[model samples]
Structures are given as structure tokens and as C-alpha cells.
Target: MARVMRDATVAATAEKIFAACGPSWLGDSYNHWSAAVKAWAVGATRSLPDDDRRAIVYKTQELDDALMAARRALEEEDDE
Candidate 1:
């Protein structure tokens, strides 16, 4: 289905963006990248069916959580 395909693409994109952030990028830069990815994914997912949209939304949320975790780790590293 179209929804499935859309979700798959979004998932892959989110993973790549998150991976690119890596451990070296932190704070404002990390936040900026994550925000941009989230916005883009959300915009792309909007056209999907409700069920498909929901899956994409959850992945977005998970990405957000990962970004926060990554940010926190970066901050902690900075503190040390």
C-alpha cells in the first residue's frame, strides 16, 4: 500500500538523520538537525492514511526521544 511505502521511507530517513547526528554533534546543532528532520517527516506523512500516518508519527516521536537522549549524552560529555 501507499501508506506502507511512505512510512518505510520516512523511517529510513529518520534513521539516517539520527545516525548522522552521531556523538560529536550536540546541543544547538543536534537540535536543529532533529527539528528539521521531524518537520520534514511530519509534512511528508500528512498525506498518508490515518493508520499509516499514525505509524509515521510514532516513529517521529521515537526519533525525538532518541535525539533528546543523544543531546543529553553530549551535554554530559561536555560537562566532563
Candidate 2:
């Protein structure tokens, strides 16, 4: 199905983005890189159908939240 394929493609792209820009304790560089990736994702998905675009946005937000949580955990560990 086209929708299934679109979902798979979005998932694959999310994985690559996460691998390349996952959270780190590097502060500004990490923030900048994450922002850049987010922008790139938006641009890349601009031509997708509405549903596909929404799926990618949701996935991206999910990944971003996970990365933020991981970063917070690392900071907590460092603080202890």
C-alpha cells in the first residue's frame, strides 16, 4: 500500500535523523545541530501528502522528546 510505504519511508528517515542528531551534552553545538536537522526534515517533507507530513512531524516530535528526556537523565547523572 502507498500509505504503508510512506510510513516506512518516514520511519527510516527518522531513524537516520536520530542517529545523526540524537541528544548530547555538548550544549550549543547539540542545539544547533538538532535545529538544523529539524529544519532539514521540514524542507524534506514539504512535498509529502498531508497525512504523510503529519506522520513525519509526529515521529520527529517523538524523537525530539526522547532525546530531551535522555539529555535530562544524563544531566541528572552528572549532577549526582
Compare the candidates by TM-score and give the number of the best one.
2
Model 1 score (lDDT): 0.58
* Model 1 CA RMSD to the hidden true structure, in angstroms: 6.6
Which tens-of-lDDT digit does each residue in 1-80 have in candidate 1? 44555656768865665565543243344445545555555666355454554454456557766767877899999999
Instruction: Report the Cα lDDT for residue 67, model 1.
Output: 67
C-alpha lDDT of residue 2 in model 1: 43
Summing lDDT over every window of 10 consecutive residues in candidate 1, give the lowest-scoring window.
22-31
lDDT of 2 by residue, 1-80 (tens): 13433667887776676676664334334444446455665667355454554565566556666778887899999999
After superposition on all C-alphas, the RMSD of every candidate to the true structure, in Å, is 6.6, 5.9
Winning model by lDDT:
2
Which regions of candidate 2 are displaced past 4 Å? 1-4, 17-46
Report how far residue 34 has shifted in candidate 2, in Å.
13
- The per-residue C-alpha lDDT of model 2 at residue 50 equals 47
